[model samples]
Target: MKPAIALPLLGLAPLLGASDLLVKALGIALVALPLLSLFGLLLPVLRRALSGHALWFGALLLAGVLVGLAQLLMQAFAFELHRALGPFLALLALPCLLLVAIEPAGPGAGLRQGLLFAACALLLGALRELLGHASLLAHGEWLGLGALHWQAAADGLPLFASAPGGLILLGLLLALVRLKP
Candidate 1:
């Protein structure tokens, strides 16, 4: 399954405890809806005879890096929604990177895959923000991360809280390193 389709479901874990029954149902729908939409968007492309799995993998890894960076920004800005949803979404990047690193094939395909993944990430991020805001308004707090709205916890560590992104970046770098002749 596409990261777009999978990340939001994974992201729901953080939000589960904080949400009420109705809010939880809404949240689940909100997350699942976007994945469904992304699936619709991607299905046509997937139906095509595209065989460059490696490039697609690299694209996904790149998209993960971008998603991580966005989450880092959210953390920096103390966006509670991001703190809740960011890491889980970030996790999707790994399998894609591994896929690319192990069996990447073409050159341009990675770029295409990256663009597709980026589109999905952007869509999911926006949805999360909107749904989170709504959930907070209705329930008096965001879904998962609670009312503790503070800047990212600081111990001056690299990739401190956003470790998933950091790991994905490391994976991407390693892939590149291995790809080098």
Candidate 2:
């Protein structure tokens, strides 16, 4: 797959998983930034040390390790969220590996890509929550906050809360981005 499509396609699952709740999205962004930042910094150096299949294996291993560490940290401090995220947290590694493969050049490029992904996660998460539940951060309690939420409507488009809704919203957003001036 092309580099651009590869990362998002691989990442779509985790993005959908996290976008179910705004708090979950925050959890993902918090984890993704550091994971990608560290991964970005370390992978370039590791690439210099390996080649061929070894490089791919090493990159996968590295991404897995980084994701595992984030999972452990989440489990410890955010047990509820960790459980809610479930396998989706592990699926995060796929995008990381793809990110590493596509931008093996330098940390900055990888980090920029990571930031873009994290931003998307946050944007999608917030939009989904607002549209689906008519509230933002409505379940901060899930993240242990329990006190911060904003409700603006009695009901919202429930479809936005589901997987299909996420895909539809994503397509619309992609279409918007592709629009010419």
Candidate with top lDDT is: 2
Per-residue lDDT tens digits for candidate 1, residues 28-141, read 333433333343344334335344675465456454555565456546654555444534544434433433333333444434443444443433333332333322223325
**Per-model lDDT:** 0.39, 0.81
Lowest-scoring 10 consecutive residues by lDDT in candidate 2? 1-10
Give model 1's TM-score versus the native structure: 0.29
TM-score of each: 0.29, 0.91
Residue 119 displacement in candidate 2 (angstroms): 0.8
Error of 1 at 99 (Å): 15
Write candidate 2's Cα lDDT for 129-161 as tens digits.
989988888779877667888888489898999
List ranges where model 2 is wrong by over 4 Å. 1-8
Those runs of model 1 whose alpha carbons end farther than 4 Å from true positions after fitting are: 1-29, 52-78, 92-140, 143-181
Give the TM-score comparing model 2 with the true structure, all chains together: 0.91
